[model samples]
Target: MDKHRNLDCKDIEAITALLSKDGEALNYYKTNGAESVGHAFMIANLLHLHANVSEASLFYRHAFNLHGKSQTEYPLPQSLLQVSLLCLLKAGQPVPEEEIKELEKYAPSYANYIRGILIAWRGGDVKEAMSLIGNAFEGFHSGEEIDALYLEIALKYFPALTAPITDTSYSPIPRHLYMYWDKNPPKEIADNIKYHQELLGEDFTFFNQENAEEWLFEHFGSETLSLFQNTKHPAESADFLRLHVILNNGGWWLDADLRLKSLEQWEMLSRLPKNCRFFITEKFLIHNDFFGTVANDPILANALLTCYVNMLKHHGLYIPYKTGPGVFSRAVSRTVYSSFNHDAPLPSLAIGTAWEMFSIVEEFEVTYKSGGNWHTA
Candidate 1:
């Protein structure tokens, strides 16, 4: 199950059947009394992949209990416990005191981190929760999953703590709009681009495979050029490009598929306060796909710096944490925390309520005659 193969419908059906109560695999295990902690853990992972969070949480708990009671010589994998705790948290299920105590016995720092997230989720002391989360970043050598999860928890629960102090002294984000595609874009994407151009007129700039590299080389030099070239997917490359472009040019970076919901939304963008970075929050995570900021904004700088650092340390790891939303969210958190603690001068960051104001064309609605989905790539 850990093997890296793209799951097709048949594979999904088989896995679903195996986990079903009346299915042959589950029935056989039940009849033979052959269930093991390892098997249950596998079931939990499958459930998680299928997005059955509640069911996955139960399976993870079952695995944890089984591991504790079994006589197997192999020590329990720490990840099983950690992921179980995360699954429970994400499912909005209660974590037993005994389970938390067990986690504390094994990894005290991580236990504290989990407790911090729980505190924030439950609307306890905001300052204390932020402090614990900040400390957890320092205490643990977290993997990409942990980093992403931590950022999501912090942003979702303590958004105010992660927003930068507004400095009205800078300059307003320019009305310019930027978007990119790897090659010849599909009709839907092209249509969306045209629509934005109709709104912004000559302020709109589109980058493609031919001109995007030249632009990167001219603005950022060879190292950035090399990094852009080495990106594992078109989406990752776009992630790298958008940050640099916005940092240097100071304008709105819109995904190719995005368009304004109405003229009112366009007016809304125009009405945003000057010298402040603007972003939309969907489900508490700050989206990088469509953000506007002044040139050389520290938040954008930090996000780009994070991308470089993650690439150097964990090249080609998870894209979101490596160069996408995960790292961007961290940059926002760090900037806000620094301002709060040190009273540093920084631009005010505005987080809008929802992304629905700007419509995103669903991937399914477009036929990709050229470059296909970047994730699968």
Candidate 2:
């Protein structure tokens, strides 16, 4: 309230300039004793929000350390205390053991929740994760909001890995891409997992209907065909069975709809017979926008039956995926006539009216017959 007090304001400006630099405020707090809780917590929050994570974690420790605690003028909903620690944990900042001891002086349950957070943060245990969330709020549903934010932090910070797509319970089957996902994780958790970033490629598979599967088993024998995920999308699912396929690996691609009296009937399987890289199906007629259902690939067949609402990325317009080959074939049209297969017919049913890439499909023996009543050998 006096002119002499105005003279002290200039020192504040000089210190403010160094705020961007780490440890500056902590050092100032050590020397000047910071006057009040507001200044110290503000400095700590600035570092936590702006500095790179490791630096921020160190700064946060210092902030809590120097502020000398008991900042709450009023008690938060009993649970938000747990929520607070969850946020700190998600931020990759550990609550100090000394602070934990101090909090225990007030409430034992909250301290227990902090312990749970530490355990869940160290080892990914769902029980600990849920318990920490349960202990985070008292009256209202702030626990839900905290859990949501914490999960957002993990998902944003860490790559999501969901329940194993399949635990076929066997050793490595056939896969090139290992898709690891957690439905959603805390955002900060992603920042801590720097080693996890990688480009994910497509996993191609094919599926057939139950009758189709019966037909497949009847004709090819179970030994040659590996049955995976019975729900459908077999064409795409088949590829995921091995996890991922690298481009140009010798994997034979086929739509489940393309039936066979015998697997040995097609000579294409003979020349490039390897099961690693993805296989191009009996080339479609041409990017015809045809549905695979006509062809009988239940994988595509089932995908068409989904109730989730919309086709976000692949907004291809087609009546039914029955003629997917025709649609895809039209996309890249190349007639693959096999001099080897005595019965190789022109791809009439698989032909697409609007195919763009129809010129370069690899030549191989895949028979396509115009629709007929008789399903013959």
As a TM-score, model 1 comes out at 0.73
lDDT of 2 by residue, 1-377 (tens): 11221112236554344453656555655565434434544554555555434333333333443443453642232332343454566667666675566556656666665675676667666444444434332322211233233332222222211111232232211322122112232343232222212211243333223433443456545732343222134332332221111112323233222222232322222332121111122321222111121123322222222211112222232222222322222211111212112234422122112121122121223222233421211
Q: Give the number of colliding residue pairs in candidate 2.
A: 73
For candidate 1, list the clashing residue pairs, or say none.
166-348, 167-348
lDDT of 1 by residue, 1-377 (tens): 11221122235454355468434434433443324676666666667777666656656665665666432433354445666777777788786666677777766766777787788778787667666656455332223344444555545544663454353343478878799989878788888878877877787899986688999999989988998998888888899899989999998887876666655555556555654444545445667778788888888888888888877787856786678876777676676566545656544566654544344222225565345455533
Question: What lDDT would each prediction earn against the true structure?
Answer: 0.66, 0.32
**Which is the leading candidate under TM-score?**
1
